[model samples]
Target chain A: MFVRNILSAIIISVAPVSSVLAAGGDTPPIPSQDWSFSGPFGTYDKAALQRGYKIYREVCASCHSMKRVRFRNLEALGYNEDQIKAIAAEYSVEDGPNEDGDMFERAALPSDAFISPFPNDNAAKAANGGAFPPDLSLMTKARANGSNYVHALMTGYKDKLPHGVELSDGQYWNTYFTGNKIAMAPPLMDESISYEDGTIETLDQYAKDISHFLTWAADPYMEERKRTGFKVILFLLIFAGVMYGVKRRIWSNIH
Target chain B: MSNAPREKFDNTVVEWVDSRLPIFTMMKNEYGVFPTPRNFNWFWNFGAIAMFMLITMIATGIVLAMHYTADTKLAFDSVERIMRDVNGGWLIRYIHMNGASFFFIAVYIHIFRGMYYGSYKAPRELLWILGVIIFLLMMATAFIGYVLPWGQMSLWGATVITNLFSAIPFVGESIVTLLWGGFSIDNPTLTRFFALHYLLPFVIVGVVLLHIWALHVTGSNNPLGLEPKSKKDTLPFHPYYTSKDFFGIIVFIIFYAIFIFYMPDALGHPDNYIPANPLVTPPHIVPEWYFLPFYAILRAVTFNMNIYMLAGLGLLAVFMVEFIWRHKPKYLNGFLGFLLLVLGSGLAVFGLLADLNQGWEIPMSAANLAPISAKFGGVLAMFGSIGLLVILPWLDNHPIRSARFRPLFRIFMIIFTISVFILGYAGSQAADKVYFMEFNNTMLAQIFTGFYFMFFLIILPLLSRFEKGRELPKSINEAVLSKAQKAGA
Candidate 1:
């Protein structure tokens, strides 16, 4: 009876789908892609992380700021402390007031957040034609189907608008974007950044890499979370088994 | 009480402590040798599981609170900080988040088990009522906790639900303002919500204590719906049921770990990741999945009372005709029953179709006479759905306790379950527009909402009179013996 009821319920719930097909026209479906860190045992691919960091530095970093991540955090992506120090030193960051009580610029330390190109939200908006460049810190978590949406938007730019549609001046057509028009133009091109590890530098590879890097930025503890979860579950199984044995021994004389 | 002899401490220190506090005596009385029906199956394990979940949530919640900021501007960032900066904070937050979901899951199963076995009958009525009270406190706690995240759903959900008070008559506006701590959900609202969210769980803990005390007073209802007649029919709660509860907890924790580790966001709304934006309303706004059935009931009230009056009158006519034709009511039901059924079905179909089209056009004269607006009706419907549960112990007047013996009651139970699922599905749909069918989602919601109330208020009481229940086993021992004999054969 339970199975039958469940089956009937499923049928009733699913029966309306055919009638609602037209309702889905508003937002285009997001395409799915495989990730190295997709499952319980999955971990970040270190080589991709390095290439992704390079692509971010060369292309996207000028527009987007990963304000939540410090230069030292690059160690998680396989960078040594000296390399991190060198990278941080390459960028000049605003520092505290001197004896004159005025702000001054100094080479950034590894602890400093990746610097923003624009000073503030207003400046970012002004530079981008009224569209503020969003901070990249939690971008992977901010949208639905986050990584897929990011990858799709990067690769979805079209050379021509769909037949009847026309774009206003700065709007670029990207089929995956909500309105199929976006303020940011296509940021990646073929061979945009040469990887130090000799990996191919295709546009798709750059988009995927950056997506992976952003995902890590959003959830750096994914590896630890899965690891701890596995251990806890294993311990619980053994503990429960022991508890069952104790219970049997205690009740052995009864009933 | 169990026949097992109570253990006596021989040591002087143990005796002295026992004389002072009697803590061991209380524990021995309440848990060590407390008699429990041996016939209880896996379903009975949820109460223990729920208690464990409560502790897990409270423990995790206290730690999370230490690092959390209640200020609106920082609330969102603080949560992000907890996830990114604090050591082991992600695990704590995930446990709390997924814990809320699991808590509801366990409680729902627990409530359904009570309903299935007639556990709320007779001496256990107060126990059932206390459970209902706990359920209400839980809903309130979950609602405010959802807002503490300061996400899009949090802000907008706060606005929508707090505004529900505006359905009241004269002081509605003031009540909403008072609740919000201002004209809108803002800094004070977030601070107060955080305070209340922190406080209510402790309140729930208190009520849970009273609930358990009541449970102990009445003892547990077994699957057979028979009280133990002798000690042989029961087992000590300690050693036996405690081990069972431990096993249940481990199993439940495994399920929780899957959500926390593998698919943390599976139960969460994606829009919640975005910080609250008052200017941009989400395309569709829905509450957490646990609240869907009630949310759907609220949205279902799209039409005024004309439809309800018509349907009520039609049902009354059917009942009257059946009453007059008493002896041969079954054969007399064909033509009129078919006609009335079609009329009822047509009214429902029209209501849903009209809701899809927008709303039913109420005649100007009838509009004022319509006791309340549809919005207010929706609020009443939502609250009424929970309120109906309080009276369930009385509504069910069956001689037999468990549905195992009541074939007709079992059918109604199935219908009740289906209606709830339908309401949940409707609730999950976008509230602004109808989808999936030509009929409006609100209209479908209303139809299911009608079934939900009817199951409790009408079907349960009415069916109890007509149902000829099957024979039930006289005692738990007999039931167990028969099962064993069948297995041996």
Candidate 2:
């Protein structure tokens, strides 16, 4: 009954709003996929997030950076401490000045932020022909309809330019991007990154996995939050119900 | 017994303090036996709920300030650190983030309750005015608090809003600079906003104390807009209303928890998650959801001043001069009327000169013709929206409180509510976004803005003069017992 009531409420609030609040009139509608962590009671699928991390490391990491995510945070994806340490050691990060008073690099610790491909935004922009690679730590959050939008951009590339459309050097056409123009080339394809768990290795699978992964990355506390929310709301509901009874009892003689 | 001077407590500690300070006596007099109208509905819950949100915000904000770094370079990263590293910091920050929206929600419902019940009339006027003051303070607090995160929207929104100060004519640029603490919105601006954001809520609390004092003075205006007459018409403040308010607050928290836990960023703009970068502004910079209606008003007035506006103002000069001189309908005639007529004609002259100034390019930059005047006009309209609420008690003195008895007013109230909601929706869309033929969001906002002002300025006065209200109940007792009987209780 609790779940049923919550389901009705979620439907009441979400159904009409999603249909009506579609913004940016010129942009194409981003088709939403079933996300593991979509609702109030939903929790992230850890294995999917781990698979997404693989796709990110193999394909997108060369350009984008996850500046806010720490190596230790990957534990949320079911990594043990040793495994997290091993993952941390795989990438090096900038450290402090030593006896020589010069900044140096060392093997990364679990506490360190994700390593960046480019040292600075200026260098990244110069390398990419004046197009700076944005940080992806908040990418799924920093845009409206972020998860669907990113997924569409991943698989949205047009093989041939649509009628009279032309690209200027690096500019690529993506079906879902605002104005249909994007700076980066198509980043994923069939077998973009193979999964050992026997997950399908198609472009669609790759996009969905990464989208799931990025969603987890953006809000790592989803599982804990929803779990806590269930208990909190349940308690409040009971408390309110009992309080109403008490109020009735107190006011029984008022009339 | 309800109005008795004192009741001895069992504990000597209380008796000693009571003898010295009489605070215990004060509490008992003010709250313990205070007679509140027993006919309160769901709407009465909002006032206490609004107070609950205020305390919640303050509690969360104080904790957030502890972990926050005020510098421009560190502010965004510090917030991330709070989210990632500090234990339960995400919960605190998200509560504070979504708390502002919820705070506005409660307060808006509270204000609308006042409007629907005509709670602003007579002895409750100061109570309503205090509420409007608290509301203004809340807006300032929320706007400055938005800048504390130092995100793209924060920076750009700060820049745009502070630039509004430049519309002050001679001291405009200086005021903007003073607000920014520099030529641009940078570190100094961020730091100062943090300081002011922290300060404004306490100011709101002070005004809220005054608000509560005023409410206690005249007592709560119920849904029926009737004051409690005697014991039968009222309930004591102990287990009865306290129990009800607690239930209301907990239910409110349930919704707040849903936002904080599941969709924390739903009410917020995605651009805000991006750190502040002044050089590249977001393509569309919208204020937080609560500010949308006023933002729509501001944007709607972006058209050039023309002959039509001049003629409209020239016609409405009488309304302006009349609004300035008289507070009530009776005061609208005689010496005040004759004096206002002369002043009204003078304002028409000023309106003609203003029309002439549009073409001639006046020395006052804000008053200058063309685009700036329109922008300035937008700014005026936006402020006037709230400003009108401050004087609403005088504007509508339709003897009968509550729209339940006044059929015409009930219709006007519904229309006014609908228009505000429409204005809110129009504001949420892109200014140039057109859903139909020839009419864009800006034009939609414009028509509704006119409707919004007209409801207050023209409709209320007209209703006061002509509309005969239905019979009021003999008292709150008569209404409640009848309501119970109709329900077959």
Candidate 3:
């Protein structure tokens, strides 16, 4: 009886595999960049991070917010405490009531997060034609091939659309965007943000810098993580060797 | 080295504890002086490694939970805060995240090792079942824990899996509603999942304790699959196995540490880092890596049988056979048979091909008969794949317990492992999509899924009858001595 039941169950379980294949429109492939933080030994390029922060502050900060990151986290990007404080003070942030139970606006402290341009999602959407710009704090970790995708999308805006493809009023053509149309217009242009280090202020440079910065924002502990990882691995290897010797010595008496 | 009775405690403190609880005797008997087969191989170490991973997960998980917020609106941000704001929270979160993948990896190796040695046979059957129950609990725990992050994959995975319960006959919709705690996967679902996630690991710990007790009762099964007859065949577990387990653990830890620190997100889906959005779904939804093989089995079933297409293909096959036989008369019988075989297979293939051009829906009642609806069949197949493991003891009629002594069974075991990996690869692909060979991934998955079941249900039982077994050693001592003699010679 059990055998019969299993046999019937197997038969019932085995069935046809059929479904309409919903093929997505072709997206331009994201070209990989020479990231200073790609491999196990890779560390963030400090200068690139600073430039990226400039681009983010001058351009991207108008719409997108890095809500999870505080001004203090910029210390990882080679910024001094005074520089971070100055940067934080450049933006106005909402503060608590002063015995009047009324919320007041004040210059942001070094501890405060990079505040959103709009107060909430509904307001953000209203300002950006009903499309809320996603928070950039975890942006580098959120999408598949995130870092490259961000870089590509930033620089992928073409002057002409592909043959037979039409863009709606608000939608802009970006080669890297899914369906080749994105709500976000090309935000970066040549000479968008000048670097204090006298680096070239090309659109490509801005895109690369911002992608690097976002990656750092997403995982500020990458350099520390990799360094600690290497040390731990080294210690484990040495410990394992010692353990192996001990095991051999213990087993010799038995064998 | 001797099997003589243990010496009595000389110290009054030891005697006092022994008299009160006999905890010393229990430890000395169960662990210190426990008899284990001397010929047990490295594969045997996986159980200990799995235990280590479990403890690692629990310890790290406790720390993570201390910082994690279970609220829907705050869950994503709280996790980020854990990664950024909390002191060494990054280390704890990474360990817990990668620890899950490592835990599954260790447990899988342990389960496969059990299968390879036929540790589920006879006296050990209950032990294997308890292990399976633990596996079920682990899956539940992992799934719920995944939802606590409240990411894209978390929300959708919860939605997809909870919806599977809705495939029930009359109560399907209500079951989904109950599972959701409201109309859809919302705050309540996240809270309950967090609650259950926190609770199930303790339950697993309880089951694991029972699993260990069962293992101790039967003793450890060795690679040779021969029972230890005398004291010569067995050794005390403390110095020998303990040192060996310690070495194995260090090796396992090196690999675990590499993943935890170096490539922490390698095993995870990047989409999961995005906060959960009900308005949008990712292009492809897939479960974690360990669940992929079973996920593939779940997706293999399709409801549209295409009976008309099958009939048409059959008629075409008949015409082709007649045409071939008419064109060549000398090899008429062989050609006709070969043509018929080809045509029959073609007809079956036709039945399996989903009509991508048409929007045709078969009534649920009709679809549930021979070829079940894709949703219902997927749920059953997913569950049935795991169910197969529970009855594996009954499925194998072999007198021998280990594949080392059964050459034919060994080949089938290899094929079974390969098929499972193939199913895993297929499961990782976007389901319902056509890939290489113009055949959908589900169709590809179905072939492997068939092989997976066939190994247990058909090949194992039937092969056991006809396959000749190798000469058995009288005891483990004899097997070891013979091997040593061969080495010396």
Q: Highest TM-score: which candidate?
A: 2
lDDT of 3 by residue, B130-199 (tens): 9999999999999888889999999888877787786666887788778789877899999888888889
Clashes of 1: 0
- Assess each prediction's global lDDT (C-alpha) against the native: 0.81, 0.83, 0.82
lDDT of 2 at B351: 50
Candidate 1, DockQ score (0 to 1): 0.29
Q: How do the residues B313-358 of candidate 1 rate in per-residue lDDT, one tens digit apiece?
A: 4675565335332424765556776676667666645543544444
Give the Å shift of residue B67 in candidate 1. 0.1
The weakest ten consecutive residues by lDDT in model 2 chain A span A2-11
TM-score of chain B of each: 0.88, 0.90, 0.86
What residue runs in model 1 are displaced by over 4 Å at the alpha carbon?
A1-25, A97-101, A248-255, B1-8, B306-364, B432-437
Off-target runs (Cα >4 Å) in candidate 3 are: A1-24, B1-7, B304-372
Error of 3 at A16 (Å): 17
Task: Please state what fraction of the native interface contacts candidate 3 reproduces.
Answer: 0.62
Off by over 4 Å in 2: A1-25, A100-102, B1-6, B304-372
- The docking category that best describes candidate 1 is acceptable
In candidate 3, the residue pairs with backbone N, CA or C atoms under 3 Å apart (3 or more residues apart, or in different chains) clash, namely none
